[model samples]
Target: MGPYGVETLPPGVVDVPAAPAACRAALVERDRFEWRPADGGDPAALTEEFLLGHGLAVDDLTRPAGHDPAGPCGAALYVSAAAGAAMAGAPSGAANPVATLPEVAVVVYGHARPPRPPRRTEPGRWWVGPWRDSWTPGEHADAVQAVRAAIGRGDVYQVNVVGHAAADYTGDPRPALARLAGLPGARYGGTLHGAGWAIGCASPETLVEVTAGRVVTRPIKGTRPATDAGRRELLASAKERAEHIMIVDLERNDLARLARTGSVRVDELFAVRRWCDLWQAESTVSAQLADGIGLAALLRAVCPGGSVTGAPKRAALELIAAVEPVGRGAGMGALGWVGPGRLDLGLTIRTAAADGDRLHGWAGGGITWDSDPAAEVAEAAAKAAPVRALLAG
Candidate 1:
């Protein structure tokens, strides 16, 4: 049993209805904090009342959320490290605790935030509806151009293209997400439903897992449908090889910033792994972060992963900032469970976002000098299929 009032349950276990209410109470009862999500509730306002009611500093509340472009990229909220520390048996904020949040795996939890009905500033609100807008074909083309430029400079070869579509929704996102889960050849697949209207189903090929003192990151660079077995050579072609190497090198450098000098190493190079929906070639990079490296540093070091951003990360980021039409709120963010002395996070990809009435999602492919604009455009559309079909009907 934990002081926070949660007890350990069995694997594939779940907490009862009272769990979330109690967890919310733990923060709301004693602190002035807010847990607003893309959906709507104002945990901040509730936290304020709790702080005033109890004797606590509002700053004591910490936010344990971030953006990842590869897995379920987006902003997330969680019990701060301090909050987790205060609660006996609670995991660190850096480690994702969603799975343990009572009924997360079994019952659909609340949206990332809460549903904001209608207001003067924003009037559209709905329940479980298509809430996303599509990017024009030209804009999509420009994105392809940007990727080509990166490839021309030998920065990267292929980057996955994710298009954005927003929606206002109600009801459990599980059904929508389950549409793609376990799809043949889709590696690192899963859905992360938040407390708001935000939800995403990602078929990530990358893995960032932490065990004991070791941290491992697998940068997946090649992609082709498993059904197209004959295209293996083309899928892992020379151009894709260069792209994988660039990102792998960038990852090595990023880890070096926090990892012990000389401890960083590439465990594997261009190994092909088949998943539910696709076949991918990925390289593994491992490192030992310096003693006392915190979550913030580790994340900051490799955020907006090289696979999406290109090599020379800072430059690619500048490019993204210049060309991307909107801020990638949660697109390309990371999500997963983390615990004391251990953590596991996946890069967010194949995702969607929703507000009150608008639902959005995106898909794109990496472009190099050898890349075909037409192919890239088609790739983007292909990635959008799962979400588009969901929004259509």
Candidate 2:
């Protein structure tokens, strides 16, 4: 169950029959209002128009903020990196596994009627095949070097490059999802089951939160093993600090477009926090929303988060497309609830998406001018280790 007591909708009884085939059962909470493109329009545009027309009240409450008290209402959305790239007018290269997923899919929950809670039952383990990387270690290191070259040429200050991995499995993925959701420091964690595809997420990074007209976004950049010495190293690393601040500044600028002049501020900078076995550095940026700022406008300015894309977002995205071999499906997107009086979404970092017998996941870090190609490749492996282990069973 989510922190707010919001549980995933049960199977076989979803009300929204108009949802696309790829996302027919991407339900958030049962007995809540849902909105999606019936005849195939822009998902972002459709959602924005729906929110504006409904005029839902927004309040400043911490997420999983429980139900609305007066009533339960919220929206859970997932937009792939490919979808975000298309929306930002960045070129996405050839189709990959993620390309088979939806461009944008959302499930809005509304009203006081309690949603059906998921049953309490342990999932069964299944056999899994050996994991394989989309790009070999040497090739991944070469890609990192290419990113450093771009930074050297001043094409971009930082670029977040990712690698994809997959392993074949038999039987259900619920047991793996359960294990992932129980991971240490999992704040926004859940599973979404479609016809033949399912996405399991145990994300810790907050992409954006809107409550009581105040908008806040926490961007995480640096990561190290959860050790006393690792914490010290993270805090003292100048390269990590530089990359963190660049993304923070980019986030502040993105929020400023819909925020009142002088209302945007950095609340916290370089705060170390624990997620699973890693210590991550995060910065909080908040702003007061301008009057009449719709959800669409806000999403347009910050759909693909800066931390995931990197500084000079457009340039970084272009380079990412040219370097990375595959696309990021649900990984690095947003997942959480958009309620009547609040909205909370998490960056889909520690996430996995399953289609047929194959389960897919991705991991990477920001590449800067000082980034070591070999170290960067190692970082990707380290980041993916835990998730791979959970799914191995």
Candidate 3:
């Protein structure tokens, strides 16, 4: 029945052209905005205003000190690892702090447009050239040794060492991104495109997810192949297990700041999970938000996930910057949706970015004192192989 006794639908009153596709999420061409840390503006504040402009509630969001609250809403979010480090004032290995990319890239769409179908593409038109590693195997090994030295010096317990690879490609990279989004066991997988660039993320780790009112984060730390032997090896290795626990602890601490007193809990601990051909140790830590916890506060607690940065995030980031040759562009960041009172982001581990004429990717593992340099280097290769193979075709 209709409200106030009106007919739900009066007979034969339909539009001649019918209606829009209700199931599709298309875009308006000019909705994307990129925020660079070097720009001397605030991403969180801009986001709050963007949501407010869309008529969403911003009063519930946490505001910067001495700043007033505004409204905010639906947006596509991409937070680069370098951006996170830059915000924290962590040193970067590269001379440029935030790289050429924006620290935070946002696409503000309230789903007001009609659907746009995929562009016409030839089956074999896509081309990804051979990859060139930014750091040779010896260099990667040296980074691992450096991390071990840091641990020995009592500077850091562990640090994640990542290696970058780049290649030239022709044609659109969206096809490659689409293929990656469909990878097996991808919980929070998708592609986000910005000015002259795009990213494909097939990461299994859940950086953070907020639903209803509860917040949760899954940090993945240790990895081995998805084999019977690999499973046993991963579960049995004291080094792997210890490494995994350290990250789990770090996540707990990160979330505790925002959590209600005595509301934090570890739902799952060091469970082996499969992501394509690899097995990784992941833990689930969840907490109930304290009174009035907002989007900016949540993002501040856990972007550039601890699993990617290693234990004691600040020190690890500094050491990592000094060790790694190139910056971690789109890798080791967060990507996902942010809507009214909701956020679900995944860490960019097995992720690749297409910038200008080049496609870039990075992979690596946590380096503890017990870490073997050669093994760490090989592990990074193993993680990156599948993405490279999928893009090659």
Q: Please, what is the TM-score per model?
A: 0.63, 0.85, 0.87
lDDT of each: 0.48, 0.72, 0.73
How far residue 91's Cα lies from its native spot in candidate 1, in Å, is: 31
Write the residue-wise lDDT of candidate 2 on 45-83 in tens digits: 666555444444332232223444344344556666665
Q: What stretches of model 3 exceed 4 Å from their correct place?
A: 1-30, 58-73, 92-100, 113-124
lDDT by residue (228-319, candidate 3, tens digit) is 99999999999999998999999999899788899999999989999999998889999987878776667767866899898799999989
**How do the residues 138-167 of candidate 1 rate in per-residue lDDT, one tens digit apiece?**
777877787777767766444444455555
The model with the greatest lDDT is: 3
Clashing pairs in 2: 32-110, 33-110, 59-211, 59-212, 59-341, 60-211, 60-212, 74-338, 74-339, 75-338
TM-score between model 3 and native: 0.87
Give the Cα-based TM-score of candidate 2 against the true structure.
Answer: 0.85
Give candidate 2 misplaced runs (Cα > 4 Å): 1-41, 50-72, 98-100, 110-125
**On a 0 to 100 scale, what is the lDDT of residue 94 in model 1?**
24
* Candidate 1: Cα lDDT at 364: 63
Question: Candidate 2: worst 10 consecutive residues by lDDT?
Answer: 15-24
Instruction: Give the lowest summed-lDDT range of ten residues in model 3.
Output: 11-20
Q: What lDDT, from 0 to 1, does candidate 1 have?
A: 0.48
| Candidate 3 accuracy as lDDT | 0.73
